[model samples]
Target: MTPLAIPAHERHGIRVFAAALSPEEMQRDKAGLVAALFGDPDLDPAHVELFDTADLAGVGLAGYLAEGLGVSDAALAPDRARLEAVRGPVLILHSRALHGRAVTLIPDPRLTLLAGYTEERPPVHFEPLPSDAAKGSLTAPGPSAPAPRLPRRALALGAALLLAGLAALVLAWR
Candidate 1:
């Protein structure tokens, strides 16, 4: 029995079967399917798959899509294999930005197209610190200066005063 056109809501679960269909055949099929569902002629051929919904869903269509679309499996093979081995839902995304138009097998649809583009701005200027702040207060203190030494002359004067005071006291006692 011929399969009915897949519903839009069910498109997520529907498995696309794509192969070496001639360019002409691909155009024709693409046109018909696009008219029925998206009503747009810009359907991405890379998004198409070749397995039935059940098999694709069962085998994790994301990995199959990535491999079939000539996407690099080297980076994603291990994780893809693990997901396929577990038989879980898969979502694959193809973009020129990532792996160069290669199909990337993303096991979680949430993970696909997570990164978005935005115009970047130039770096902002930072204000310099104000001057006049105490260097020791503003910055950590370094080694302190050594303690002051007493002058030799001052020491000699102190000794003379002590001797004179003792001599005066002895004379007063006499």
Candidate 2:
């Protein structure tokens, strides 16, 4: 397995390996955002354990994270409740491969299910309806400046004056 190496500065001192595993195979049974986070050596291992989407939804991100982060059960009740209230998909690893040795694996999906963790965005992809705005929509908070324009009255007046001047010159030349 080709290990994705993070820079030393990026990860303090621990050796963190993020295995960008495909659906066919995973190096350490880690996938998605969990694998991405686990790739950092500084993160607590017990907290970074496998969490498929169902497991996350069932436990609530607060409860799931509380346990993973080694916090008390009651500590994350609010977080869990918030996740339960939302209908949208939560960030989680889709599936985790069986663990082997120390390296952790994460899946490379058909499209990115998570963002905002990094400065860069995932590559663009095409999606059908309930259309994904990020992929195709041109709508944006209007541009920093308005579109340039020439007033219709001004343009018409300028053209008329130029034509009048040309006509005068032609008459004088004659």
Candidate 3:
């Protein structure tokens, strides 16, 4: 299994959102992994969003790849299982490249696990994606996805009105 090579054109929008799964877990979790890459494999690539990795954050098979690796650095080692795990969920956004062709990665010593295929990259900031099904209250909201502010004054007024109504009822009963 070769290291999964994201093509030159496709790498820009490829961001692993740092919410439900940590940056560490995103490299490994199955649901988070699959959702981030292939995007609900049932759908075609054009309409599919590339990095919505939050969907499978808490699945039963989520951490199968990360299992037994032990420590973050050790998980970074490039191997057959690592390559297989990486390739399994990744989608080919461009075409239906047929089987039996050997895929080659342009070997660069500088490339690390987080290092993407491209050189000049757009800012991949921590923007909170809307994932009520995924993070819920477990993680902090991303910059783009702020949590809804509570309507404090409305609640207070409602409570006050209820109390007044109760008092009037008590007086009428007396």
Candidate 4:
């Protein structure tokens, strides 16, 4: 499967976590993948999360990855292509690793696969984003409507004049 993408704006908030399990490993231990994630010292225990891609079976995997994981289309497209070429269950690993720390997305060129594997893993890495990299820009503000005009002062003055004229008429009649 394709690796998850950390947005430019959220680069500091998340880490790119990717792992692949052979069909044998999956069959041997349902928690093997979880163990691998927890076993790593560099990965923060609190930030690590695993999602079974098998859960997304028959559903639009691309859309789910985009919406749920906030994966960019750039990453999702390649992953979708790879998944289409394979069969069987795929598990998705998502880990923040460190809170508010930027991790760079470096594509791993080597595809790691175990014996009798039903799925393939693309090269992926989560490293610190370079300081010189351009940061993502915030969304631009939309056009604002002009404020409505209200004649509050004129209305108040008219009401006061009417009240004074009535009071004068009443005194004259008296």
Candidate 5:
């Protein structure tokens, strides 16, 4: 098993690894997943190193994929014991359809599972707080300022415009 390494310089920030039971979930919503994890656009990318479990197997982490789960092409399985060798916390983004099964498949105490996907902007502040023991005095990256929200007046104006457009359509239909 090729150990997942975080260079000495990168150790100060949280180490993030992404595993998926379904490859399509990661393939389709990777950016959204990252955004969901680190909502602050200004958060340094180096603070979190995102790696796909599928790609890990290519790099010689054998048996990285789950086996005997009766599912085809399942993502890295903590059941294999190789995951224990990982240095930090792992975040598993799995299909909503397998929410129940994911619980049973991944039993590593270090792994966190997030089920479901949405194309719309995801809720922010999704990262789990790392324990001091796990991080070893390393300073976790601070979250940047939240995205500025539209003022009430701007929102009201947009709503009014939408309502007017709808009313016009209704009148034209008559």
Candidate 6:
């Protein structure tokens, strides 16, 4: 399904038209026609609005639209009245069904299926940590205080001897 990002004013108008379309009448071009009537610039064969009235328990339909369109739910809230005007390819999600309701008039033939909601993953780097700071911090634990004046060769030999002693101890313990 194509995802349409409608602006606030437009979404309200579309919602009104969609609510009236129902499930039977809104098939294919019909949906496009309704959208076009509502002045939808992107209302073409490829781009169309899918009226989702699914399991909106935690988040309401407006919220879902907001999340889907990447906008605030308040923007879509005022358009409910307009949304109730159109009957088109509408999918009532979840176990809830709209029956005989005035807003639920017109069977949208385009309303074929009502799929479950799928949460969208935000952008991969939408909230990336400050890279410069992260990189600086990663390398910030500086050279470990210069090892208190131990010579490089002496340190190496000491490490080797320590390792040998540890190996011997392990062997002895075993």
Which numbered prediction scores highest in TM-score against the true structure? 4
Error of 2 at 162 (Å): 99
Query: Model 1: per-residue lDDT, tens digit, 1-174?
Result: 122233232212223222323334434664354323323334464553222224665445445445444334554454554444433222222222122322223221122221111122246897755775633355578999999988999999999999999999999999
So what's the TM-score on candidate 1? Answer: 0.23
Off by over 4 Å in 5: 1-11, 17-21, 38-41, 45-47, 58-174
Off by over 4 Å in 1: 1-30, 42-47, 56-59, 74-174
The superposed Cα distance between candidate 4 and the true structure at residue 88, in angstroms, equals: 4.3
Off by over 4 Å in 3: 1-49, 60-98, 107-174
Clashing pairs in 4: 104-127, 108-123
Model 1 Cα shift for residue 55 (angstroms): 3.4
lDDT of 4 at 55: 60
Q: lDDT of each model, Cα atoms only?
A: 0.39, 0.41, 0.36, 0.47, 0.39, 0.42
Q: Candidate 2 on 97-133: residue-level lDDT in tens?
A: 2222233333234223221111122458976767455
Residue 161, model 2: lDDT of 100
Residue 89, candidate 3: Cα error in Å is 12
> Comparing 3 and 5 by TM-score, which wins?
5
List runs of model 6 lying over 4 Å from the truth. 1-17, 29-42, 52-58, 73-174
Report lDDT (Cα) of residue 147, candidate 1. Answer: 97
* lDDT tens per residue, model 3, 58-152: 52111322342111324334442333333222221221221222333332222223312112333579977778765656667667967787799
Error of 1 at 100 (Å): 15
lDDT of 6 at 58: 60
Backbone clash pairs for candidate 3 read: 30-62, 128-142
Tens-digit lDDT track of model 6 for 1-174: 233232332221223223445344445465455444333333332333445344355655555556654544455556644433333334332111211121222333443332222233355755656677655334355565555687899999999999999999999998
Tell me each candidate's TM-score: 0.23, 0.23, 0.18, 0.34, 0.24, 0.29
Q: Number of clashes in every candidate structure?
A: 6, 4, 2, 2, 0, 28
Could you tell me which 10 consecutive residues in candidate 2 have the lowest summed lDDT? 111-120
- Candidate 5 per-residue C-alpha lDDT over 20-119 given as tens digits, one digit per residue, 9 for 90 to 100: 3244544545445444443323333322334554446443222322231122223333233545444332353222322122122222233353321112
